[model samples]
Target: MRLATFVAFLAISTTASPVEKRADAFGIDISSHQGSNIKWSTLKSHGISFAYVKATEGRNYVNPYFKNHYDGAKKAGLLHGPFHFARPSASSGSAQASYFISHGGSWSADGHTLPGALDLEGGCAGLTKSAMVSWIKSFSSQYHSSEKRYPVLYITTNWWKSCTGNSAAFGSSHPLWLASWASSMGPLPAGWRSAAIWQYSKETGSTPGDQDRVSGGSAALKKLALGH
Candidate 1:
């Protein structure tokens, strides 16, 4: 995440503004399998303000790729956070919350970085709508809001509807990180407009993981994640 590398990544900038113009914000998601390594220079150069690195899963599984990326993100001076890939088959939401706390590195202890994220997708296939909402609530409630008010809720557009048909069940207070790979942010399903961070694509060049296709990369993103 070197500043020089970030500059190189920004060399191919499109017509979009360096900062986003709309209400939402943008960032990238990284995992262990992406293979490409991230450097602070890259993040700085590309104007990347924040990132979410894969942390751990269920009970025993941990993402081997998290440490370096997490370290690099912090070094680059970006607001860094970790996410857990929810495993719906093996454990209850309460159990998953316990596992996430045990394995997901200490963000509060290290620094008041961005809140933790729940990467819910196909992996969370077994839970009913009630169960899914309960799982989210169980995990989010553990983190004292006095410390970090809202933990992130990461989910796809359609999956969110099917999983939490009643968005009200999720409590409107928490901010969302919606993942929609479509060309435009339009067609964003109901109950997601409250999202503070919208992952529009996987095409980001700064972070060495999925290149998120994003709408804008403005300072607003920095404010949302870094609390500037």
Candidate 2:
């Protein structure tokens, strides 16, 4: 009787959990680490709709292959944009934001261009939770001032909670590119009820880099790019 009850409980728990649902749009993110040679047209043929290319890190270190990736994606008919890897400990947020924008992280109203993203991982760079949140705010503010829209934040829930105390400060304004390399999305951070893009896998294959799914599909993705 006890074994039967345990099995039944396991079944119920499994059924109650939300699985990762497929989205209409799939994309990939790339950096200098991914090398310069990428088959963008092949990726597009394989159903890739968008891409995020790394542009800068900290207040220096621009990705040398940014143009190669960006232009390649555009030429292949995939919407694309640049992203910045944050180095909160190395410099002020505004300084880094300015550096990023000057390098390649700027956004335009072009339909094929997506808004820049901030890669906000790496254990807060040794900042306190409050300091981290303030740094993020400063970066977001600077980006918004320059681009007229807040940058998408590429972060994991665990990192957000640990680094910023899961602050809801940007949830209402910024779109989240959630990095959860798991079968389940698990719990979201404090502010966001849903992710704009969910990075579900780190495995590379036909897509080029990490795999990501746009939450609301192509329509939502276009809206993100158009700032609508």
Candidate 3:
């Protein structure tokens, strides 16, 4: 009974409350690990406004369910896009960016399609801090050359500091999709003043995957999708 009550509370808290409904957007980031049976329409009804689907990693290894998640999110009326897992030690950033774009990371002007995101976390993959920063710049530049917009950068404060030696090169250009996972967003990486998206919890409630909070409401969400 306590577990059930706790679940009820979590559902109420994670799904947009009245105040959040008026001011912010809630979303999820998912991959094949979440399985292919997601009920996206139900999540939208529960106030999910967007979704990020894992698309590719390295120069290969596309997520098998990328299309399903992208199509399902679109059908459910959620702004949706793909994210690429960074592998700086395995391949050139430009090559990996090409692989990601050719596979499913391409962006369009469609209102519901969001620009691709770069999921850069974990260890530095043995690259020097300068190399890591250069790798990221190469990836961002390549993605922009192809898609006409820089990919959103998904990172955590500690990882950013440790891996890239707290590089601020991309902060001015790339959107920060910060993974803080706390009651509130803590200190950001150097250079960024705020995050465009915050992955607040790895847990899901009335949603299929990790929970996220958008900084601005629907207008900002639309602007992000529009690449403004």
Alpha-carbon local distance difference test for all models: 0.63, 0.83, 0.86
Expressed as tens digits, the lDDT of each residue in 45-66 for candidate 2 is 5557899999999986999999
In candidate 3, what are the lDDT values of residues 2-117, reduced to their tens digit? 22333344468755467766688888888878778777786787678899999999986999999998999999999998999988989999999999999999999988888999
- Cα error, residue 145 of model 1, in Å, equals 7.6
List the candidates' TM-scores in order: 0.77, 0.87, 0.92
Q: In lDDT terms, which candidate is top?
A: 3
Off by over 4 Å in 1: 1-9, 14-26, 109-112, 144-148, 188-190, 203-228
Model 2 accuracy (lDDT, Cα): 0.83
- Reference-based TM-score, model 1: 0.77
Error of 3 at 63 (Å): 0.9
Which regions of candidate 2 deviate over 4 angstroms?
Answer: 1-22, 204-208
Residue 211 in model 3: lDDT = 77
Q: How do these models rank on lDDT, best leading?
A: 3, 2, 1
Q: Of 1 and 3, which scores higher on TM-score? A: 3
